[model samples]
Target chain A: MIRFENVGMRYGAGPEVLRDISFELKPGSFHFLTGASGAGKSSLLRLMYLAHRPSRGLITILDEDIATIPRNRLPELRRKIGVVFQDFRLMSHLTCFENVALPLKINGAGSGVIKKYVSELLNWVGLADQANARPATLSGGQKQRAAIARAVISRPKLLVADEPTGNVDDALAVRLLFLFEELNRQGTTVLIATHNESLIRRFRHPVLHLEDGQLVPSPLRPIVPLRDRAPPPPDSRRFSDPIYPDAPGEGGRHG
Target chain B: MAKRRGDIPLGNDPASRLLPWIIGFMAFIAALALSGALVLAAFSDRWSAGLTGTLTIQIPPPAAYDDEAGFEALQKEALAAVRRTPGVASATLLPLDEMRALLKPWLGAGADPRDLPLPRLIAVTLEAGEDVDLADLGRRLEALAPGITIDDHGLWRERLTDFMAALQLAALAVVAVVALAAVVMVIFATRGGLLAHRESIELLHLIGAHDRYIAAQFQGQTLFAAIKGGIAGTGMAAGTVVLLGHGAAATGAVLPGALVLEPMAWLWVMTVPMALIVIAVLTARRTVVNALVRMV
Candidate 1:
């Protein structure tokens, strides 16, 4: 669970990028964060992910105050949250498998568990064939999926994503959302920031709309608690041969 | 816990390339200096023991008019006079053959001992508990045989000890300076690695890397580099010291201590690499930890 009240953030000495921001995310809920360019969506996500300290106001994640928690304890809290960065910041030198396995490694998972779980996650994300490929060789959409796999590989309690579906096609995008929705039903709170309007309408999740660093009120609330709904089947089919992203004007460079 | 997963990607750091060589060179210098100090310490101990409570008396040969028997009698008289001196433990007239053997190292083995006119020398040992007054002893010997000299070896031992102690101090100073230089180089290299991987480090932090985890990556690289450099440098230093000792012996010169190292001394020489490795690893760990704390 994340709660932010009157939180304002800015780069050192710069004008405030996010002002009077406030929201409460209940446990096991999923929401879409929507805004235009310079709407401070990324800034807000940065705070939620514990990347930057808020310049003012209170932000709490999982009952720990971001302002007062000791720096040494940050790692334990951070491990519980997964993040899909906007640029898909994978280490260029690591293979796709290695990148995805990093979170588990950091969590001190056994080698057998790491190899087994990482392989299963990569297969689910349609990247099993690209396991040994480095980030530089992967197409844009492939890179995004690899980043997504890494973020979710640890099965983090809270997953924050920034433009995670940007480089994928509509079908692939919907599949990724369904994957997120599946994760939500399992009680992982999910927040995704994006500029895609059609995906927003299709999913119809509660929207945290930001304009000029302010959150606009939305009448639509949570449809129901995720625990009230039946979980999706484990063998639900996905786009397995994700070799090509068919989204308009964003087809991957490789295929 | 993944094998070979150093998330920082530090292998590409130019610091990694240069650390071993730098540490190797420093270790070499430190080993040599340490060996020199050890040898000097051994020399000081040996010389101090050999010369303590010993004295020598030089009796000039009889004048031209005196017959061989007369000169012999004069030598006996002077030896008796020294024997009667207070605090004299034992006195005996040194033989010509023994003198030749003692001088063999300085004067080559081929040199004829009988060719030169030599003075009659008296070997004297003093009582351990008693201090001999050399001025009185010299005066008494001179009365019996003019131009007699009592050489107590006191001034010579004092000067030699002072000189050797200063050399020991200098050797120790060299070891200290070399250690300091190694620390500085390791610090610089660690800082370089930190700078080169700044972005990866920031990413590491965001993804939940503990400060200790990041430090261990640097330390692991340092551990290998230090071992590589330490062994090579120490091996070279041992070889060089052995050669130096052999060269001193090969010259057939009577140099003090002869640069020969005892087995224990050689064991001491081996510590240089172990010490160098420890210094490098510790410096790297401290540097990484300090630098990481300052990171965003």
Candidate 2:
């Protein structure tokens, strides 16, 4: 859960990019952060992910005050939240498999667990064949998928993604949304920042719309809690079966 | 393959590649300076021990006793006086040929020994735990044979000891300066690496990598480079010292055997590489931690 109250952020002496923002994200909730270019969407996501300290006001993540927490303890909190950058920030030198496994490695996951889970995640994202390929060789959609896999691989409690569907086509964007939805179903809170209205309409998640350095809340019909939802089918949880039923296991391979 | 934990990509930069070579060069200079200091210390100790209870007597062939027989008679009388002194343990007169050989360096090899008015030298050894009244002995030798002079070797030995101390101090200063410069270079390289990999670093930081984790990557890289360079530099320095020692032995008379370092000095030389590795690791770690502090 993340809460920001009257938070303002600026880079150096520049004008405040985000100002007087107030919001709260309940545990296991999902929301879409909608904003135009330079509407401080990324900045808001940054504050939520504990990447930047707000210039003013209180921000708390998982019930701990962000300002008062010791710097050394921040890493533990960070491990709980996953972030997918707009640029896809995959280490160009690393293979897709390595990039996806990075979060688990940082969390000190055993090598066996890392390999098995990362392989399964890569396979689920339709990147198993491209697992050994470096980011430079991967197409934009592949890179985006890899980034999403990295963000979700560690089973982070909260995921903040900036423009996750920005560079992909509509069909690929829809598939990526399905991935986020699956993560949410598993009790992960997802806040995806994007300007794609059609995808936002299709997902029907609550929106935190940013305009002129402030959050403009957009309400929607309340969704049911994750615990109240039915469990995923046994075959859906099995690695042998593809997570996405409609897409062919070998389809959507990008270079 | 799954990437190992704590593995960072910053070391791929060209700046990182140059660190080992730079550290090696610095280590080379440090090793040479350290070896020089060690050798000088050994030489100083030996010279002090040898000269502490020793004296030399020089008798010029007075115009009154110019001939060989007269010089011989005067030298014998001076030798007898020195031997009779309370603290004088032994006195041995230098043959004319030996005196000529000692003067050969100042006068060319072609110079005839008989042409020069070289002083007749008598080496004196003092008894242990006994002090010789050098002035009294000198007066006694003068009464027995004119132009006889007592050289206790103290003045030249003290000056030599001072010279050696200054040389050792200078060598130590060079080592200090080289070490300081090495630390500065490593700091600059770490900063360059941080700048080059800022994006990856920030990504790591956001994804739960601690500052120490990031620093350890830099530290490990720098330490590896430093150890490689240190071995190359120290090995080269030791080889040079050994080669010089051999050359000195071949040249004979140029340097005393005591000037060569003892086994302990060699051990001290062997530690230069290890010390440089520590310096590189510590410098890199501190620089990285400080740089990361400025980030979120």
Candidate 1 clashes between residue pairs 3 or more apart in a chain or in different chains: none
Where is the poorest 10-residue window by lDDT in model 1 chain A? A246-255
- lDDT (CA) per prediction: 0.84, 0.83
Q: B129-219 in candidate 2: lDDT tens per residue?
A: 8999988998888787777888877788889999999999999999999989989999999999999888889999999999998898898
If candidate 1 were superposed on the true structure by all CA atoms, what would the RMSD be?
Answer: 8.1
Compared with the true structure, what per-residue lDDT tens digits does model 1 show for residues A1-255? Answer: 789999999999999999999899998789999888999999999998888888998999977899999889998888878899999999998999999988878777778878887788788888999999999999999999999998877666689999999999987787888888867765678999988777776675889989888899753445545565444446433322122223222112110
Sequence-dependent TM-score of model 1: 0.82
| Total backbone collisions for each predicted model | 0, 0
Q: Which one is best on DockQ?
A: 2
Q: Supply candidate 2's per-residue lDDT for A38.
A: 88
RMSD per candidate (Å) reads 8.1, 6.7
Once superposed on the true structure, which residue ranges of model 2 sit more than 4 Å away at CA? A169-172, A217-255, B1-6, B45-53, B58-81, B84-89, B95-121, B126-149, B249-253, B256-261
Interface RMSD, in order shown: 1.0, 1.0
